[model samples]
Target: MRLIELYKSVQGESSFTGVPCIFVRFAGCNLRCSWCDSTYTFQGGKPFTEDEVVAQIEALQPCPLIEFTGGEPMLHERELLPLMQRLLRDESRRYTLMMETSGERPLGEVPTEVHKIVDVKCPGSGSAFGSFRMSNLDALTSRDEVKFVLRDRRDYEFARDFIREHLQGKVAEGTLGGILLSPAFHQSPSPLRTADNMELDARDLVSWMLEDGLPARLSLQIHKFVWEPQKKGV
Candidate 1:
């Protein structure tokens, strides 16, 4: 598979936040979001065979949680599927798998055992906005998650309406996995973090969610706070 870096880090988003996990970051992406933090993943990565990828993952060790993320991991589902199968079916250890995708690809083939964290780009995400494959909503399982990255009240409202329309009663009915809304961050590749890295404050987001009673979780990329905001491999 075409690869970026494979490293162990604490999961910084989704319901699995703060958990120690191994991140398999694949290279290349189709969409360019306004606030994308991983633009480095769009191109230029070392090549690795499936076996090489497995060896690196095993080196991380002890952390049973593994996340397949990328510029977009779904782009390599052809190879990823078998890798996930091997890890899940390993005789020495069992790994909990996770994937983060842009929700623009067909997910019908993804295994049910993998925790899929799909993103529905808010209008503020610019070019990637409305690029989500609406059909993927039907593919989400109870172990899956739908994420919305917001930049302002307008984006928050868009998320609210989306859940109201397509994700109707999923949260209340417990038929689907968790829904999440996160503030877009101004990413800078620097060691000294800036004062305004976050475009939308988490407090304001929480207020909006409470007032509207949106049945979703408030997701903060905790790694940004724990480490430098633009630092890679975390």
Candidate 2:
């Protein structure tokens, strides 16, 4: 596997927030979102075989959750499957394995036991059309989540429309398990001024959700606020 970095920390997002988790950040991505933060994972990573990668996780004794994230985890198609299978075999670990994906590839390749968090990139992200594999969404269970990082009101509208148009009929009618709407964090204009950037404010996002009664949760990248934002490992 072309591994970028791995470490143990509190999970930043997802329904399982604030829990201690092991993160396996892989190398390379297919899309180029303008606001992407992990440019480091796009290339220049040290390569490690499946066994070596697993060994690193094993060393993080007592970690119960594992997340496979990256520039785009699915890009490294060769090593991902075997790695997930190996994790499933570790009886002693009893960990909940999850993956953060861009929703560009065929997810059937992933093991059924692994939870998937799919990202639906918004228009403001230059790579808007590059995300969201509509065909593979139904393949996901309630355990999976669809996330959108809103850059502005337009992006939020796009997300809402995408959900209503594509996912409404496929997923069960009443309630969906996990759907998150997060605003992209930007500080160039001014760090303390929350609404300085084109990104939507949390209050506005909540208002939109309440007004339309959208069936999705709202989240923030908790790790970015909890620790040094630039630090590679969580």
What tens-digit string does per-residue lDDT give for candidate 2 at 141-190?
A: 76788889888899899989987776665455533457888888763433
CA-only RMSD, every prediction: 1.5, 2.3
The deviation in Å at residue 67 for candidate 1 is 0.4
- TM-scores, all models, native as reference: 0.96, 0.91
lDDT of 1 by residue, 59-132 (tens): 88988999999989989988988888888888677889999999999999888999999999999999999899
Best by TM-score: 1
- Clashes by residue pair, model 1: none
